[model samples]
Target: MKKTIAGIEIPDGVMAQAATAQIRGTESELIFHHSLRAFLFGALIGYRESLTFDAELLYVAAMFHNVGLNVKYHRSPYRFEVDSANAARDFLRRHVVIDRLIDEVWTAIALHTTPGIPEHMSPLVALISAGVQMDVRGARYDDFTAQQCDEIVQAYPRESGFKRKIIEAYARGMEHRPETTFGTVNADVLDRWDPNYRRLNFCGLVLGSDWPN
Candidate 1:
């Protein structure tokens, strides 16, 4: 059964997939709820803005966007975004999804954490990032109506202490592969959780490099 949230229809087929089940099974309840909220908030934004996008693609992208935080992918050497992107790609391939659509979903997951760039990409890519920002940082929280927010949250409650849990999950995921966190927001998690963790300074790197004048 499909459901409409904020005037956006979430197809049943997308939600009933085995891959989607894997996400629900593997990710913490907090992360799973956050993912659903991201999609709902994204759809709400798209509806309000009248942005044309593939709803199913956005749904899948949002669902798997944080799968890298799951323990199964903790050891992955790449950034969590890349890991999640790969997982989504693999899942779509299993369903014999077309290459063009798979590429869009992959880009959406891969670049969801990236700033500025995704806004210039396809609607799916842009919407995933927007949804993530809304849920994670409340980037555009004020733009959403109180009633809309209430309904969305009521459907998928953000349990108490969600902020701390999400931060810890991010820290643990990056701690397993700290190197990947060097240049991203994941670094902030490491900085907060691991005092000894030092972020790479691009300016310092450039200055320290040998140069001939």
Candidate 2:
């Protein structure tokens, strides 16, 4: 059941799996749509930039990148990113995927939220971050043409109130584990939804460090 969305091909193997269906079934409609958009946008970027990558790996990474936000994973002590990575690893292992490729996918999902680092890593990891950024914040919105954007959104429409919905999702996912949001965009959600939440100050930490100069 390979299908093309906005000119990007999603392989049948990736789409046919039970785990993929579980993701679609468990995740909210907004999250599921966002995941599809991430893969399409990532593939488009790779094509535009003439970058080579493993499409299946990138697809798997994009699809399962946010599973930690689901309620089933809320109790895990690890950060949402790590939980998502672990879920992807377990899914891949069940299918007998090679360890090396599983490791690559795990890295892509785990580091997708971190800034500055994934862009310099392997293509699978770099594209996952790139796609997430483009979808979430329009970080590279200009890289895609108007038609491309329109088509992608049409295939996986961002329903009305998407901004608020996604923010709520983020808040719910990280609220119980505020410590994990300290250095990432997840912090913004906590700051808004949890009034008592205080953001960490990198400058203050730097100044407070013991230095023997």
Candidate 3:
């Protein structure tokens, strides 16, 4: 039987179970819990907004959203988000998921770290971002009622130092691929965490280009 939280039954099926199996134990308790909360929050938002989406797909995307932070992908040159998204893509493909839906999940994970853009895309994309933002920073903390919030957190509790720890997790994940964090939101992690890391100025890049100005 699938668990229910805040009146929402966690999506369950062979595929969903497979996704769960793939992520659990591979991720730290902190990151794993956050990922589950992200799915539940996204589901709650979808219910609140009456948005239609594939729960299974959203669940898979949420499960794999931060897997790039794992040690296996630490050597990947791309941003952690892209590595995570590709991980989901590969999983879905192994399950023979259709290209269209695979792309949707890919986009959701790849862009979850990106704020404004995902929210403007499809419901699946927007809800994925919404869920992640809510978990990572409480982007819409007050949107849900107290009961909803309590129920969700009750099902999956955020650790005591989640805010600080999550940033630490991001920093650890991308510290190896610092160059990838250059223009993305996670760059802030390296900026603050590593005193030696500095963001490359966009103006500097353009002006320093080979084009003789």
Candidate 4:
């Protein structure tokens, strides 16, 4: 029996099941619940916008979006977003999903942390970001009815101090590769948590570049 919340049913496809198993098994309880809520909230946003999208793909993307933050990939030099995207891409490829579809998921996960851009892309890309924004940033918290918010939370039950905990997760994931967080919102995590952290300045890089005009 598939579960339903906020008028959206969990995708019961084989791919979704495999993705769910992996996420639930490997991710911390906070992440696993957050992943579920991201999918639900994202689906609700899509429903509100009346945009057509593949829920299964969205589920898979949501499940893997924060995966790079896992301890296994913490040492990688790439951005956690790219690392997470790679995990989704590899999963999709192994399932014989087409290259085109894989790219959509990959791009969605890669750009989930980026604001102001995913909204202009495909529905899948846009909604994934919107969902993330809603869940983490409360981008449009009022857009959803109070009941919907209550329902989703009741279903997933966000742990205590989610904001701080999430920031800690991001900081831990990227502390070893601070360069990757240079120009993205992830840097905010380091700035807040890492007392010795120095942010990279884009203008400074520009002025100091070796290319002389």
Candidate 5:
């Protein structure tokens, strides 16, 4: 959607990218796509949820968060976010995104990895980081692994603060499970395969509808 945030007129290309990342199904694609969604949702939620500046920064960070997924997948799977961060730095520099915003985006992306980093200096970064961690760990209150439950308890040792509540909410939201299997019917995703239904269109998330302007 062509929504303006922080006075910057964001284009649909960014939103399309977000959608593309969302419907991605590959193991590699799944994580990066979730990262993008988390960022977008985090960004919008940041404003809609708490009117926080950090959330806005996180939203921006999420847009470019996984730009390096392809590169990292071809290189080192574990380094996806790191490579994506470097790519983001370069892209932000060229695109004239302010240095502080670049730093915040980079921080959010870097801290989103499993066993996440928590050195974010802003509330937005902290919030996004916490949300991402919750998603990676487990979103369901009853679904937490022993280790995950321990992590949750440690992450929110106190059960009565704004941060704790926000984190809990994020965890709850990330609990949704999407259908990831490839359909044998008339699927048009980029990765669709059909020897019988060879008339099917291209694979991957289809960008058929007109994006928001």
Candidate 6:
């Protein structure tokens, strides 16, 4: 159940499972459940500040952040921390770009559940993780008026249905493979949806990737 998004191939079923686990349970959210959101937040930051970074890492991080949630909940709240870190380490070990930071990436995944544990990866990871925290806590932007925050919250449900569909597609083995090697399906699909649906969508296109018009 794999699909390529923005040149990075993802296992959609695993993520879907994570999301289902998150919605039905309560102990801690699965890393995979919120991955797209994290990636979107990271992309937003990247676009606004002109930061240069690898979209692959952002996508990977988002896709697998809560992998530990696949397991049933335990009495201890921190159990998923190590589980997620190990899963992320194993997953990222296959990639060359993030190979050097495998240890750091694991640390980020493990510590992401633990607030106050500073992020060990690059600043981009930190920023994106923060955005994720904001989302989980339902925090509103300090700068935005109360009304604006209300509007955003009302218009966009906290849950992400597009990601669910994407994951379902992946589970069904529906993939978007480009005939040309030059373009990524994620980037292409996102580009088409950006102008029309950017406001309502929280896929986090602006987080750490460029959205070319």
- List the global CA lDDT of all models: 0.84, 0.86, 0.90, 0.92, 0.45, 0.46
- How far off is residue 152 in model 1, in Å? 0.9
Q: Which regions of candidate 3 fall more than 4 Å away from where they truly are?
A: none
Per-residue lDDT tens digits for candidate 6, residues 21-114, read 4433532233334555455554555555566655555555555565544534222243444555676666666444346667656655555545
What TM-score would candidate 4 get against the native?
A: 0.98
Report residue 169 deviation for candidate 2 (angstroms).
Answer: 0.7
Greater lDDT among 1 and 3 belongs to 3
Q: TM-score for candidate 2, please give it.
A: 0.91
Each candidate structure's count of clashing pairs? 0, 0, 0, 0, 7, 16
Cα RMSDs of all predictions? 1.7, 2.2, 0.9, 0.8, 17.3, 19.3
- Model 2: residues >4 Å from true position, as ranges? 14-16, 202-213
lDDT of 5 by residue, 1-213 (tens): 455433223335543454344424322434444454355434433444464574334545655555544522343433445555765677667657789888876776666643424433466665565555444444323533465344333432423453444333322222221121123211232123323323323342365535543
TM-score of each: 0.93, 0.91, 0.98, 0.98, 0.44, 0.47
Ranking by TM-score: 4, 3, 1, 2, 6, 5
lDDT of 2 by residue, 1-213 (tens): 667777888756744356558778889889989998998888888888889898877888888999998888777788899999998999889888899999999999999989999999988898999998899889899888898899889889998988888888888998888888877878988999989998888887788889853
Using lDDT as the measure, the top candidate is 4
Stretches off by above 4 angstroms in model 5 are: 1-32, 44-51, 54-56, 71-73, 76-78, 114-120, 139-213
User: lDDT score of model 2?
Assistant: 0.86
> Candidate 6: lDDT of 195?
50
lDDT by residue (1-213, candidate 3, tens digit) is 978988888878998999888899699888888999999899999988999999999999999999999898888999999999999999999999999999999999999988689888998999899999998888998898889889888888899988999999999998888999877888889998999998987899999999999
Candidate 6: TM-score?
A: 0.47
lDDT of 1: 0.84
Please provide, for model 1 over 75-136, each residue's C-alpha lDDT reduced to its tens digit, 9 standing for 90 to 100: 88999999999989998898889999999999989889887899898888888999989998
lDDT of residue 160 for candidate 5: 43
Please rank every candidate by lDDT, starting with the best: 4, 3, 2, 1, 6, 5
Q: What's the lDDT of the predicted structure labeled candidate 3?
A: 0.90
